[model samples]
Target: MKNDKADFIPIFDGHSLAGWHPVPRLPVSRAPGEPSPDPDDERYRRAMQTTGKWTVEHGAITGRQDPPGCGYGGYLLSDGVYGDFELLFEARPDWPADTGILVRASSLGSQGFQILLDHRRSGNIGGIYGNGIGGFHGINFTLDAKYDEHGRPIGLRLEDPAAAIEPMTPDKPALLDDAATGEQFLSRWKWDDWNEFRIRVEGASPRITVHINDGKISEIDTEALKHPLYNAAAVRDLLGPKGHIAFEIHDNDPGMGEARWGANAACRWRNIRIREL
Candidate 1:
């Protein structure tokens, strides 16, 4: 039942590079004695400086946000563009942090999908962010049965049927087909701690599966729909074969009430592998 076909391949298994090319970290405009930036930092600032990129430590890539107006506060990236591939990584937020994985990005802006990582009740985990209607791509089709001592679902939340019915694109709309519902079931079974995330893309559609503590949590089929944005066709044409992959370290203003940001966020990753299927 698992779709194994993908265009991109994995390069690492834990700390070892499985066989794929490892993206190099570019320098940014951070002050001296600051930490090194992640490989994805080259895209945001237009040019590489040493400010917001993170270094690989203790297994995961960490991200930091620059001050406001310093060219889009978070780390920018422009390396390792992929299409029709599978990506796997593990993210752990710092108590209350916000971050995401951006796919199909371009210099103009992010025109693809985002896999968000926020621990808020209102926001759905393993969902898409900032493509007009927020979190539309993140279809919460399932729920986990386990609950904490406080009776809350252990690392999982029930689907908001109202949100699921919202339209993704005006023309394309959103479809909660049987496959999507199945995906929700799996996602609800995930664990709370650091877990593995599997994202598979084929042509215009992508599938996501999460493994919490080495157990399958959820898997969603995203092949029937077109891209989330209206301009996706043109952007895809411009990208040609490969698309860019990036990590978002969003910023927040103290005055902005309860808006989420990537404050105190960090993660570790190993065994990153991809294959062109």
Candidate 2:
């Protein structure tokens, strides 16, 4: 007999789980001399005095940085993976930091898409990187001048690269002129302020929306990306039906802080909620 009640399980706030996993909290941290925990690891690193600098209060996770590299940072990884869903989270950086909300990421470190939270360059927020794609893939979308063996910038444009690689339709060859793009994308950013990020993934296409203090800033469509590394098939097999969510405490160039041996930078996250559609 078919049972309609079996299709729904009541949880909280008038919400029900219909083939969707209830959100689970998984704590994470980095401590001295301790190997970094794998994103898939079930163990949550307890907060320590020197290494684990994050604190959890009222269900909100906050990130703290000690001089150079006391500990890299901390993250709360989701227990399950997600495919097509809407993710909502609140973020307020401690003294202007760079963080990333990575999805569709593989345990093998191969595939995923990152919604960048950049305190450094606001316009550059939500740019995609890594795995054969150059720095800031979608944010700027500028084409690199074709280079010869000598590394000199040839006048050839991306249209030429598209022509060389036949049968593949390159989405609008990126303009090679740097001045044409302008810096307006970076100028309208807020530093040291809490911002809301919304990422919607539907199949191979992903859309990003950013709101600063409830005011709309930018919206980007990432469907036209042709990078083979970000192909749908590769991501689907690696991340399964759903993908894991992670907060990145990227260790970039020095002068930002002291470079401690074996220490990674950090970031914090709170009020993370997702609704599967």
Best by lDDT: 1
Can you tell me which runs of candidate 1 are displaced by over 4 Å?
A: 1-53, 67-73, 76-78, 107-109, 129-138, 141-173, 176-192, 204-232, 253-259
lDDT of 1 by residue, 135-163 (tens): 24544432223356996545555545454
lDDT of model 1, residue 255: 39
Worst 10 residues of 1 by lDDT: 17-26
**Can you write out model 2's per-residue Cα lDDT over 105-132, one digit (the tens) per residue?**
5442223566656433221354444321
Q: Estimate each model's TM-score.
A: 0.57, 0.52
Off by over 4 Å in 2: 1-53, 65-68, 71-74, 107-111, 121-123, 130-136, 141-189, 204-224, 228-230, 252-268
Residue-pair clashes per prediction, in order, are 38, 9
Candidate 2 steric clashes: 9
Give the TM-score (vs. native) of candidate 1. Answer: 0.57
